[model samples]
Target: MKKIIISVLLLGLIGGASAYYYAFVYMKNRKFDMVNAEAASVDASVLVKAYQENETSANASYLDKVLLISGTVSATDQTQMGERTLTLSSEDPFSGVMVTLDSAEAAAVNVNDQVKVKGFCKGYLSDVVVTNAIIVK
Candidate 1:
């Protein structure tokens, strides 16, 4: 009886440790390749317009989905943490598609440049937000 109890406790400890390592260590180190990911292609202006017209419908289609957006770069910004973001122009001057680039290579993009970016849509808040983006063109 004593041996059986000790064996069960040891198995439980091993199982717990394996679960923790897989969740934290393995998953954290895994990188998502956005460039190669399957994505819905869209124009930045159209994406913004869809969100502006009907947020619920837009969310149903775009929210949390990978998107490949093409547009003219209206602005670029670098956060204090060295994170780079760019805004794509839309028909509505007040709103645009905001994209957070995944790599430093995207920093080379300049305003007014026509470019393509792929990212995960994070829904709208005035601007359509896209995260983990990579400049495609």
Candidate 2:
């Protein structure tokens, strides 16, 4: 009957609104934890080990913080953006940080030496930075 149709429509609107309300609430509460987790120290060997272990805390620990990671350097073409900034990276299809190096030191870093860097977690798709990397060896 007409009465039955009207009731169903009303119930659908209420249910949809309720779903949206809960989703909003959940996001608000989870944001703090997701963004404030401590940055974990990362090493390639340790990362491999953590990935193998069951329920490792590595990912959560570094969720949204800066981390210093050490790895081999890959040389990139030196470029500049405007006069003040360096054009280090073009756009990426995936998520990660786009980084620029201090122009004076960019040349010393070749494609083979081991280097260390500090960067923050912008998000999963964002990149980690290597703030002020120097050639250690």
Candidate 3:
């Protein structure tokens, strides 16, 4: 009886893993986005609002790849060693949305350069991000 119970439990575990994998990773991978480095520049405000409605919507405009955005370096995270992260927020005449970067990318920007960054639309992160981010740029 104990051996039979263990077999049933093992079967259940395997089935659950298979279902979860297909539902999350497999489906999401079909439309997963990558960044592009070459494209015409766009006004930053137009982006923040579009994402407010849908993340995948901009995939058509930006080639489903990375995008180049222009904004200001509003905040940053200092590092004792290596790179420190910087937060870039929209400088568009209409909004104040924020985006994050790894320490190294963040370091290349400043508080008020009106900088242009090339990264992807990674979705929303609540207070940290209204609807846009350049995760790898």
How much does each candidate deviate from the true structure in C-alpha RMSD? 2.0, 11.9, 8.4
Candidate 1 achieves a global lDDT of 0.93
**Model 2 score (lDDT):** 0.42
Best by lDDT: 1
Model 1 over residues 95-117: C-alpha lDDT tens digits?
99999888645448889999999
- Candidate 3 at 35: error in angstroms? 12
For candidate 1, what's the RMSD? 2.0
Q: Model 1 clash pairs? A: none
Candidate numbers sorted by TM-score from highest down = 1, 3, 2
Report the C-alpha lDDT of model 2 over 1-137, residue by residue, as the tens digit: 99999999999999998888788876667533212334455653343334234323645655345555555444444435421111122123232222344333433555544554444433222333333222223
lDDT of 3 at 18: 95
Show how many residue pairs clash in every candidate, following the order shown.
Answer: 0, 6, 6
- lDDT at 69, model 1: 98
Residue 15 miss distance in model 3 (angstroms): 34
Identify the superior model by TM-score, candidate 1 or candidate 2.
Answer: 1
Quote each prediction's TM-score.
0.86, 0.35, 0.44
Which whole-number lDDT from 0 to 100 does residue 109 have in model 3?
56
Candidate 1 lDDT for residue 24: 100
Model 1 spans > 4 angstroms off: 1-11, 104-107
